[model samples]
Target: MVATIHVPVLVREVLSMLVVRPNGNYLDATFGGGGHTRAILENISESARLLAIDRDPDAIERGKQLAAEDSRVEVVQASFDQIADVSRRNGFEQFDGILFDVGVSSDQLENGRRGFSFQKNGPLDMRMDPTDGKPASEWLNTASVQSIATVLRKFGDERNARLIANAIVRARPLSETQELVELIDRVCKTQEVNKHVATRTFQAIRIHVNDELTQLRQGLRNAFELIGHAGRIAVITFHSLEHRTVRRQFSQWVDSSIPARMPIRGPNKGPMKIVERGLAPKRQETERNPRARSAMLQVVERVQ
Candidate 1:
């Protein structure tokens, strides 16, 4: 088997915060390459069970291999929004700990064929699940300028959203990462510090193609629904929007005295309390895996 490209960011923090109980059931919502999943398993007991899910079929394949090796591990091929169903089907009554390492996985980003980055220059397809949705190229080739601009602005926070959108419209049918990267360079002359010029554009396109934000929202609710009282949820997000969404929802749950709409379909006992926010990776980790530099972990425990 090929080695996993993912290095598992914030490993020490996630293991300490999320795996509060050594033998409790847990869930790893994004089992990319099984880094975090393996850590969870090692940290827990032989009696403990872990449900590992990822929308990417490659990740699922890796997960299945791990499941075959470890009896306590249960692998599921499902998106974040489908996690609850998979968990129920897998026979989890409720999770003692739930974790989400949100955003694109290193497995996807490093695979040139996945088209997540232009460094290797592959197809323009950016769907997390290549089988489920249309490719980014298909959307870019057909979407209106206004729609593209909106996606760039909202998802990428691109300063040159309109200009890039216009350029993309003119350069329709972009089928490769290099094509889009060159176009982005031509239109947006300025680059983000220490980042590629195509970063925002690729991010926006990938997010749109995968319907990531919507799925994240639904997934957060599903996590809440599946967490038992005192159970904690740890979310490691790489994007500003993703971080904000998690913080806001967690804050709402903690602030409200009543349950309000804070569930999926639960006899939700009460609000969720925050355990940590903006927890960063150790300097050693960032030095080893630069990807960990921008990642942050937030944790909240469901209070009954």
Candidate 2:
């Protein structure tokens, strides 16, 4: 099998924001294709340890190979929401830095068997970890029309979510990628320029199947708990939903206000400090990689 080429988005920005220390430990929370993990290892000192985590078994296997080549690297098979537990089990009480490259991996999308892409006719399985959780087809086939429409509207921002959901409900038991794609296309007659008509529906179903938003919210909380004082947290989000979650989390961490009902309160000091506002990929990088066009980077440092 030919190796999937995954160019890590915003490499330069991620590295610069991370501020790698020679002897500091780091965590690559989403070790998709091991692009960010590899870069971290290359830049950090040999004495510094880097733990890479991923939900996909295939990615974990690939990460194991990378770990084999370097004694300083350790790969774990787990979601980012399990970061605190995974880190503690791995002998890391706290990390000097953590990186989250949120969203689907290129390997999952390019490979039809993974079922993350509507461009390919494959099984409608969109699970990050194929071993667990119900597949997208199961959810779509069994979920209520209202539930399906809600997912489409909330996650995908689809304007014709009801129409699409109604069409899907009328045609139950969708098992293939193209079947759902065709159904959405028939119901939603208009298409965005340079984008597929089924893009939003596909995104909505995948998000619902994987529970991505919940995972993201939990992962951010776990990351904040595990990062040491002065340590940095860098997140690269590809969509508005992901970005908004990160933004809100950072804002809460940086807010100095305490609820009036709280009995015990420390000095009005926030636990985190914002490092930068929303940063986008440069024109050159976007031109080279169209996927980078929608990418946004956010950074924060734990102050307490």
Give the top-scoring candidate (lDDT).
1
On a 0 to 100 scale, what is the lDDT of residue 28 in model 2? 94
Looking at candidate 2, what is the lDDT of residue 295?
96
TM-score result, candidate 2: 0.94
Cα lDDT tens digits, model 1, 160-279, are 999999999998878999998899899877777888888888898888999888988999999999999889999999989999999888876775443333442445444776778678
How do the residues 91-160 of candidate 2 rate in per-residue lDDT, one tens digit apiece?
Answer: 9998888999988988889888888898999999999999889999899899998999999999999999
Clashes of each: 0, 0
**How large is the C-alpha RMSD of every model relative to the true structure?**
4.1, 4.3
Model 2: lDDT of residue 107: 88
281 in model 1: Cα distance from truth in Å?
1.4
